[model samples]
Target: MNRTPEPELMQIPSQVRAYADADFSRSDSMVVKSLEKFLKKAGRTLNKNDLIFDMACGPGNIAERIAKNWPFVNVVGIDGSKEMLNEAENRLSLNLTKNLSYELIDINSIASGEIHFPFKADLLVSNSALHHFHDPYCFWGALKKLGKTKCIHIHRDLIRPASDEKAFELKEKHLSNSPEILKKDFYASLKASFTVDEVSQQLVDAGLSQLEVFQVDELYFEIIGCI
Candidate 1:
């Protein structure tokens, strides 16, 4: 499948609402499990007062899970989509986590240094978000800004399949129960994703060669390391 980057923001109200209300528990549970397993492998632990920053946190699904796992840890989810953020805030309000917050920020602007986060991030994580950056440089630039010395960084996204047929097959296998909109979104994301070699080269170009890029599962690859 060729790389076809989707729009950075989910601008349509219905689309955003549909995505927010979609049941992603099956896939999201896999994300949280992978995060915990990899974080442990990196020899890090979430401190009681630690701050976690999740980029492109659509509807706060993954961020909510992180907050739940470590009740004391603070979580901040940043996204450019107002509708998505609104949905995230709504869901968060219904939860017990007072430490999880949502922010309306353009990640590209933040990556370009046009905007800056007020506080230093203890851990920076992004899941299934990297593929949305039409310009890979923006993604690398953002990583450079977030990946400070001693700050843990881990990013995971679907890997582009070798063939379009394979991409469709994977989507059917994984997202069979999902709504048509979400299934379409997943297919688009898979096509937009960078291959292993492409991502490795991106790391090298960004001076992030110290980080490790590895295929973590059948359909996903992760870029993980500390700065």
Candidate 2:
């Protein structure tokens, strides 16, 4: 299926509220666990000064997880939407987790050199972020700019279905109990996401073929490696 790009920022009030309130804990925890597993397999340990960037971190759920898991490492969650970052900051205030912060950034601007980010990441992670970019290269290009050499990557995103019918079926199957707004966004995201093969070619074109892309399940694919 040809990809249909969704809005890059989740700024709408109702949409943001639904997204922030949704229980994505199962999938969010998986991102952190997968990062730990990969880091161990790579024989790498994060130093106290090491930085982890969670790109397009919608509500900072995953960023909070990483900060809690690696209290010594500095973790920043970057997103374009102020509404989203507000949610993240509110959670941080309640959790009182150290070494974690949120930044209001339009990643495409970074990719376009319109904005300069101050920190480079030792570890860069994102969940369901790539599909937001209409041009996939922008996503990869921004990551290349943000990551230090040999930066570890753990990115998971919805996989585009073969057809709209399939996308609808998957959304209904997985999000049947979700709020209407959440389900609508999920369906749009499914349409926006890329196939594993397409993502692999994107990696190659971005001079990041060291990263491996593979389907992790019916709805998602993971990109993992040092890049």
- Model 1 alpha-carbon miss at residue 77, Å: 0.4
lDDT of 1 by residue, 56-155 (tens): 9989988998888888898899899998899998887787588899889998997888999777678888888888889988877876776556877778
Least lDDT summed over 10 consecutive residues: which range in candidate 1?
140-149
* Model 2: residues with Cα > 4 Å off, grouped in runs: none
**Per-candidate clash tally:** 0, 0
TM-score of candidate 2 relative to the true fold:
0.98
**Which runs in model 1 stand beyond 4 Å of their true positions?**
none
Q: Which stretch of 10 consecutive residues in model 2 shows the poorest summed lDDT?
A: 212-221
Candidate 2, residue 119: how far the Cα is off, in Å: 1.4
**Model 1's TM-score against the true structure:** 0.92
Candidate 2 has an lDDT of: 0.93
